[model samples]
Target: MLFDSGVRSGSDVAKAIALGATAVGIGRPYAHALAVGGTDGLVHYLRSVLAELDLLMAINGYPTIADIRRT
Candidate 1:
């Protein structure tokens, strides 16, 4: 399994997954969110990232992470 770090956005996560990353590190964004608005902010941030990833997958016709790797 490969772990990719330094991810800043949903797009970055998608790209890393597409490039065969088994997992990703997204600590920076979470840290920023926590510092800005606490737990709620972190929750919102995570939901936003997932939503963005879902949108990108739909736009690209990728039904799953495995499908993304085929691109």
Candidate 2:
């Protein structure tokens, strides 16, 4: 499977997936969130990223990851 690192935002994740990445490494964002506010910060950060990805998918008419890959 293909894995992409250096993902800093939801858009970056989407781009990687669209380009056929099977997984993404998001260590930096998680580390930053953890350092800033511990567990709660990490949760909030993850939620925000998922929300951004959901919004982008809706706006672009992509109902699933497979659809994103087709683009």
Candidate 3:
């Protein structure tokens, strides 16, 4: 399942995955990015989120998003 609402950082995505979420979502940050920075902000925010998620996965010992396990 995809998680949302409170999801803000890569760590949050990792947590959701660990709890059995197959996917995560972009909510306020996404909207805010677009509104505040236009296309550039949205693009930047998306990349940041992706990078954060990757970093979190590595820190949590998951080689990939598919490998994240339930805590």
Candidate 4:
């Protein structure tokens, strides 16, 4: 799945992963965060996205990202 969730939220990341995105490219959010809050913001954003993905996986009963499937 092709995903573009820069201005969006972590939930979108989870959705994309569940939809079969092997890789998600974070565009605008990352660049803007880096320009404003520096490296810390970028780190925070990544962490949040990862947590969202994990939470979604758990909610869907997927043991791993590889197990996430489109229903």
Candidate 5:
């Protein structure tokens, strides 16, 4: 499991996995997103965060989450 203070970027997610995290759990940010933007904002926040993770993985030569491990 990977833990951070509510990962805010895709690269952050990637790094967490690279450091050896089988699962990523997000918190705080979701609540903040909701507080700032409501349910719709939370959805958008999650999508963007996930998108960032995908992009970071693709660029780093990791085609899948399982392929990510410490460099």
Candidate 6:
């Protein structure tokens, strides 16, 4: 699937995976974070996005990102 742009949240990441994306790419958000908070901020943002994706998977009854395909 085509990602619109830089994903803003983990939920967005989950949605992309659930909808069948081969990978999630970061661009704009990283640039923005980098400009605003540098590497550390970018790291924090990326981690939060990952955590959110995991939580969404669990709450949606998916044990893993692959499960989202079946869901």
Each model's RMSD to truth, in Å?
1.2, 1.1, 1.5, 2.2, 1.8, 1.7
Q: How close is candidate 4 to the true structure, as a TM-score?
A: 0.74
**In angstroms, how far off is 9's CA in candidate 5?**
1.4
lDDT of 2: 0.88
TM-score of each: 0.90, 0.91, 0.85, 0.74, 0.81, 0.82
57: Cα error in model 2, Å: 0.4
Q: Show pairs that collide, candidate 4.
A: none
After superposition, candidate 2 runs with Cα above 4 Å error? none
Locate the minimum summed-lDDT window of 10 residues in model 2: 1-10
Residues 1-71, candidate 2, lDDT per residue (tens digit)? 56557887788889989988888778888999999989999999998888988899999999998999888
lDDT of 1 by residue, 1-71 (tens): 56557787788889999888888778888899999989999999998989999999999899998998888
Model 6 lDDT-worst window of ten: 1-10
Which structure is stronger by lDDT: 1 or 2? 2
Leading candidate by TM-score: 2
Best by lDDT: 2
**Clashing residue pairs in candidate 5, if any?**
none
**Candidates ranked, most accurate by lDDT first:** 2, 1, 3, 5, 6, 4
What lDDT does the true structure give each of the candidates?
Answer: 0.87, 0.88, 0.84, 0.74, 0.80, 0.79
TM-score of 2: 0.91
Which should have the higher TM-score, number 1 or number 3? 1
List clashing residue pairs in candidate 1.
none
Pairs that collide in candidate 2 are none
**Candidate 6, 1-71: lDDT as tens digits:** 66766578888777777788868777888888888889998888788878888888778788877887665
Off by over 4 Å in 5: none
lDDT of 3 by residue, 1-71 (tens): 77886988877877788898877887899999999999999999889988998887777687867787745
lDDT of 4: 0.74
The true-structure Cα RMSD of candidate 3 reads 1.5
Winner on TM-score (1 vs 2): 2
RMSD of 1: 1.2
Model 4 lDDT per residue over 1-71, tens place:
57666525666766777777767788987887888888998888778877877787788788876666545
The lDDT of model 3 is 0.84
